[model samples]
Target: MKVCSVSVDLDPISCYYGIHGLGEPPAPLAHVVLQRALPRFAEIFQRRGIHATFFVVGSDLASDPSGRATLTDLAKSGHELGNHTHHHRYDFARLSAEEIEREVADAHQVIAQAQGSPPIGFRAPGYDMSARVLRVLESQGYQYDSSLFSSWPYYFAKAGVMGVMSLLGRRSHSVLGDPRALTAPVDPYRPGSGPFRRGQSSLVELPIAVSPFLRLPVIGNWLLVAPARVRTRLLESVRSRSFFNLELHGADLLDADQDGIPTQLISKQHDLRIPLKDKQRAFEAMLDRIAQDYRFAPLREVATDVQREGKLRAGGQNL
Candidate 1:
């Protein structure tokens, strides 16, 4: 079965650039995401009959009254709500275990209050995670995390990093310079161990989808920017081996051209300057195509399906 899982990283506007800086107040972009982009995203998913998982930042919920209401509405609309950490911090690898626990716990509280139930899944900001972070997630009662991008669909960790390192050596403007050091893989698999493991940790890992060439993140640059024909071919190529996981940022759906976004990030990914209406049309079309070809499910359902597949492969028995 070709399973499709769509997820939105609900990070705050401050998280868009990097870590928070001193003396920066909340900006209009934050309100734009909460007020305009998110609702439209939800409506698009609903219109296409796609049930997506929204991995929300804990601080976004706690800080914005409207954001809290948006999250509640999404959960009530039958979409899954998951954690994207409180501060959208990228150095989970460096944080103490206690701090990790606090971040996850705080996010859980805010999500539970807003959605009327605690979130059972998580996705680290910038896909930055360490073994210690996983341990904290397990302790916090999270059922799964979509942060691990093992080199399954493509060799993202090895080849992708090599390319970034090469590019960075030439010039300093590479996106690779951003924190988190770009060690994530392109597909989902167990961390540090072989692909299949038993009696291991409780958290399930679901990685973002990427194309085979250069291991570019599938949803954002490749799928969103590519022409319709190219996007279709790319998704079809990856549909056979692994679950097709599409990830997006709330800002990706916003019209950067009309929205008066700061010129810095816009120039970073020039293709993003495409008109907002065009972006939405392309995104909605992609969702429609995926719905026609694959079964859309929440992360929990994907994990369950994988477990069941594993059991079936092992002499038709339950683990």
Candidate 2:
């Protein structure tokens, strides 16, 4: 079984950098990572003989020509390039259908211009999405969306509905009121037949990997917050799962001492103050471990593989 699929969310906005405690606008740390850390990340992956997807923000491509060139280089280096969003907006759940379409379309255009092809995969900022968001993604020609995580692979719909409801504060005894509620598979499962069919839609949903601990999602951010021994146990637990989807941010690998934002946001999630060197060391350690046990693939490749396998199991033509 594949134990992990590594992905990076590259959000380049000053607000994102600030909120994450990387720095204020024109985050110097962010620029450094784009220029320095990303190349190192690519080198690490290449040395390990693995490839991971990079979900880039459209605005980042527009604002930073060098960053765009670097992404194109990554693609040339055999890594997958994907779209995060144009503005990296957090309120996708509140946006209207038309608005969602425009945002996705605009981002698609920018990514295509930079990479010389439209992105085949997308990840909504904050994993915030709605049914309309899915509709637009499918219509806009995205092949996969990695924005939702299901605790259990087999019973993902029910589990994801419960998890999403709790997060959105719309949980009720009688009905699932979360606007993001949909019966799409929570892992790398195929959509239904037809354009609007829940299971047969053209797009595949590849949610982040969550651990089975207390039925909660176990992802990278959570791993960062866990104690050393506990994190070890969680990683062991992840190796036992059917599939492991690990995520990282470009900023996560950068040092705080670098010219950039303040230290509050980086330290916000954890009580202990993690210095830049330590952060880089921790990330390198995680990459080393993943390199040993997993065969990393881009999100689009994974989804396509899953779809083909599912079809084979059902005695249907390969997708």
Badly placed stretches (over 4 Å) of model 1 are 19-26, 150-199, 212-216, 307-319
| Candidate 2 C-alpha lDDT tens digits along 60-157 | 77777788898888887778888888877766545788878877888888888877777999888766556677778888888788876444432454
Using TM-score as the measure, the top candidate is 1
Model 1 residue pairs with clashes: 149-185
Question: Which model scores highest in lDDT?
Answer: 1
Instruction: For residues 81-156, write the lDDT of model 1, one tens digit per residue.
Output: 8888887776654589998888888989998898898898888765556677878887787767787543332334
lDDT of every model, 2 decimals: 0.67, 0.64
**Per-model TM-score on C-alpha atoms:** 0.80, 0.78
- The whole-model C-alpha lDDT of candidate 2 against the native structure comes to 0.64
